[model samples]
Target: MAVETGAGARAGMEAPALEGGAVLGSLLDLKADALGTYLRARQRHGDVVRIHVGPPGLRMDMYCVFSAEGAQQVLASESANYRKDNPFYEEIRESFGNGLLTAQDADYLRQRRLVQPLFTRRRVDGYAGAVAEETAGTLASWARARDAIVDVSDEMMHLALRAVSRILFGADADATTDVVHRCFPVITEYVLRRGYSPLNVPRTWPTPGNRRAAAAAEELYGVCDRIIAERRAGGDPAEDLLTLLAGAQSPDGEGFDTAELRDQVLIFLLAGHETTATSLAFTLHLLGRHPEEQARAREEVVRVLGDRTPEAADLDRLPYLTRVLKEAMRLYPAAPVFGRNAVAAGEIDGYAVPAGATVVLAPWVTHRHPRYWSDPDRFDPGRFTPEAEASRPRYAWFPFGGGPRACIGQHFSMLESVIALAMLLRAYEIEAVDTEVPLSAGMTLRAEGPMRCRIRPVRR
Candidate 1:
């Protein structure tokens, strides 16, 4: 989708356009190879490229903006000029209905405000014990297979699920976690595939993917409903996000209706676990490949906590691990591409943009732009040191995204990641099984196969 309109370049007033019939060819490239397609587009077409995407019979031209300046324009400076009207957001609502993610403007603000209190400093601090416990539990499992090659991706996914399940529901999630871990990905992958696919099939058509997604959703929703039902019946007697949510009143004073509560819970389950899992897997893979950084992080763990389990306060003390995680996210962001439909005709970074055109903001592309980082592909955590970070543009390295509509769970994600990574590194020495893991782009950036690593328990 690299657009090189030499004719338009001479005119100066017009944005470059993709040549004739290249749209279909570009569509094939995007579907078959997302990371390569975007990376190549940036290489060939500069930061701003025009491409067409949609079904075989129907297509809509969209701008793929790669520059940090363009990213700022769409996500921050003129954010109001854009809205979540894309197929991607609509499809997410299939499983995560009207949660903060798919909700727009006033509705999004309202929900964010309602849920914001759940992550207040004291409340967030309280979840540390549970997070550490789950980390220990996962480590226990890993210990049984010491020195064996393990799939870091699989282990991290389950660890994240168990931890988020406890934090979200505020109690034992053994049964619920099994159900969610079993079925949530089924629905999410289907929605993601449909949202990005060229042929837009209506979910009402009952195709195989749709049927599996629907069945998985029903089972997932039932688990949610059961949790709500149990809490109402005085089950567990614990105060968690669910407890407050169960009694949470709307801005107008009505507690959320059953459907409303369901939406919020479903979003937490999917967003809370899946994204963190992916990030952790990438973190481990990076650490496995970079042994020196791994050793430094391990040294910090020893100096800070010795043999004790990492507590909430221990997170801030491990600055280097934080940097390592941040750098991994820079290279392999969980949600690689985010789009907003233009609410009105506008110009972005000198390009004419029409109303309703999808403006794509890709961390996958911007995070690697040479102007923003020296040797952008290098795995250097020093890039995130305080002085180094302040030297860079704010929007240049957004893994969780930016502005008023930024990810609400970012604080929770960082805290959880710090805890999980610290605990894992403190316990094991990670050796890379392969020189590098192949990358793929989806709803999340993923390793195309198991990110295999050999783990040895720390002798100390």
Candidate 2:
């Protein structure tokens, strides 16, 4: 479709085509309204669409594959060829350095191997008591503030951050929470803005926002560094992630240096909490909107553990709650869009993808694909039931991604979500105050405004 340009045209050039050029431009503008444009293109142009967006000579391709087979191909089968290389990583790498999330090739593999054990099911299960205690405490506070509108997004972030800090560092830096909280918003704003803008500015340049973000990054690093130094000086051998890493020795009997330790800590603090917090927030939003499912989940939780706190063993009994989280992730994946740069020439479902081209596989698109889902847009947790789930293909629902580079924190996040949801539902009945709020995409998919809800104590 041809659309008129809002601005005056240049002397020698005609207006950019709306179907491709103008649509691409809107994405670069980072306007929330551009979502419909992208969705319409997906509907009209099939799975893969090409547009010229980035710097000259670099053509970006956007893939909206809604098939299980296609998702598997991109994430699992040919994953090695697809490493993270995009504007998102470019901005993150500035502050985070090449930690596991941003590392590639041998560096990535080595780091992932070293850090993988800390997030194992066995290790994560050990933290269940800590998770439950923190969650119950948070819920008690929420209950005290009866009938007040709460930003579930912020609440979840705080809860997740606390759990992560307790498990990872074995310390509760409540006094430092204010400083850490202030730092993230600055980083998030700068990264999101830079991801979309066309203006290329050096980070060292004296931009007010850039300076603030840099200072925040430095402050965050300083806090982590001090903690590490103190732990080293005290020389207490604990099973926490930080201590585990400190004592960890490779086959060659080597351990991470100060710089490497700082990088890993920063990556964990950012990736570990924010992603889980977003998932939990969206899950709660879904539960509020779907009262029937929420009730079913609560019943399941109550039946499993009458009045006691949930333990690691109780996780398997709460099948309904597990399905609920799985379904929520499908609708609003924390890391909705993932990209990879092609290392060599490849073909994705018969399309000739050239070498060095960027390939994107969006769970946001695939999870709701009409071909795989019965009613793609509906909130149906039952779809994740064992029989129903078995009927679907392997990669049909990958909220935590797939294959080697899949999120190492998947087990930890799932355990945390289950515990948090069970504890919260056990205490309160939640209902959405406004169900019409639009879903906005950010660092993670979140509601544009606070997900206001009414929480009443559930009568035993």
User: Of the candidates shown, which would achieve the greatest lDDT relative to the real structure?
Assistant: 1
Model 1: worst 10 consecutive residues (lDDT sum): 6-15
Which portions of model 2 show Cα errors greater than 4 Å?
A: 1-18, 22-30, 33-38, 54-59, 63-66
TM-score of 1: 0.93
Residues 301-364 of candidate 2: C-alpha lDDT, one tens digit per residue: 9999999989988889999999999998988888776667777776665555667766666678
Model 2 lDDT at residue 449: 71
Per model, state how many residue pairs clash: 1, 0
Which tens-of-lDDT digit does each residue in 392-457 have in candidate 1? 888889887787778878878888899889889988889879667777777777777778899988
All models: lDDT?
0.82, 0.75
lDDT of 2 at 117: 67
Model 2 scores a TM of 0.91
Question: Using TM-score as the measure, which candidate wins?
Answer: 1
Worst 10 residues of 2 by lDDT: 6-15
